[model samples]
Target: MTKSTKPAAKKPAASKAAPKSSKAVAAPAPAEANKVAKTQIIDMVASATTLSKKQAAEAVSSMLDLIATALKDGKSVGLPGLGTLSVAATAERQGVRPGTSDKITIPAGKKVRFKVASTLKGTL
Candidate 1:
């Protein structure tokens, strides 16, 4: 003779917390097909410069990592003919929930901003 067992029901969270999946972020798609992608840029660099494709890719990756590290350290990065990347401080503010229309206080945070170079801005 065999005994049967049933699964126990799960309990809901006590606090009304945001979902783990809500933090998902997706990069915006390019508006034009003519826009160049990372791979294309790497290939272009390989062809234009003396570096091989692999070397060019590594250099690009390292450069990006350096820039990100700088921003994380609260330092501004200046890219000649491109733009400047800097972090801005934001104060706490009041916001309303979408569905319930309940007022909520948004916490202070930092955001990245870009300033276009005058030469680059003139071209576009």
Candidate 2:
């Protein structure tokens, strides 16, 4: 018969989490609108080259696949108008974990590195 007070305790916890969830939901909309997605890029390519959307998409996909294959083979790729991309070896290092704030050792790894061409940097 005393269920009223029992429910009140749970309401505060849910209310505390609601704003955080709402903020997370609200933040992504503007970011998504701002970025040009693959679809938009394909559309642009189609119009610029006078190619059908399907053809443009295939061309873009093939180019990306070629770049990925080159990187996997540890070859440095230099796109004349874009940049140079290469796989760089990383040394083992010590770092702090963000959530737990604990000291941790990060093992050695290979990471992709990009150096923007001077011409591209100037245009940007």
Candidate 3:
């Protein structure tokens, strides 16, 4: 009788580990982002004109203050390169619960609106 050789069993391939969840990712600090944004704006202004960093900062601050004042007085302010800031009136109306259909009355209020400039609109 001839001796028969048995085939060796093959081992299963190892499974790859799952990737880390999105929650495990770290987000950038808010303060750092704010500083970067401010610096970028200042740099852009300074580069576009002869103004120094300090002058650009002051000019931006003043423009923001002016917009705030106009809104506070219920007036509209429009910026050529930025947008228009205006106060919009809302009318009181009957409202309903999104899922349950429960009826209610929504009170009228004033809201601030912004319409972007044509140049900015083109970018979007």
- Write candidate 1's Cα lDDT for 35-119 as tens digits: 8878888999999999999999999889989999999999999999999999999999999999999999999999999999999
Preferred candidate (TM-score higher): 2 or 3: 2
lDDT of 3 by residue, 1-124 (tens): 1233222222222222223333344354544655657668888998999999999999988877888988989999988988998999999999998999999999999899999999999988
- TM-score, one value per model: 0.72, 0.72, 0.55
Error of 2 at 43 (Å): 0.6
- In model 2, what is the error at residue 26, expressed in angstroms? 6.8
Give the residue spans of candidate 1 off by over 4 A. Answer: 1-34
What C-alpha lDDT do the candidate models reach, one value each?
0.84, 0.95, 0.80
Pairs that collide, model 3: none
Where does model 3 exceed 4 Å of error?
Answer: 1-36, 97-101, 117-124
- Give the alpha carbon lDDT tens digit for every residue of 1-124 in model 2: 4799879988998999999999999999997988998889999999999899999999999998999999999999999988999999999999999999999999999999999999999999
Q: Which scores greater on lDDT, model 2 or model 3? A: 2
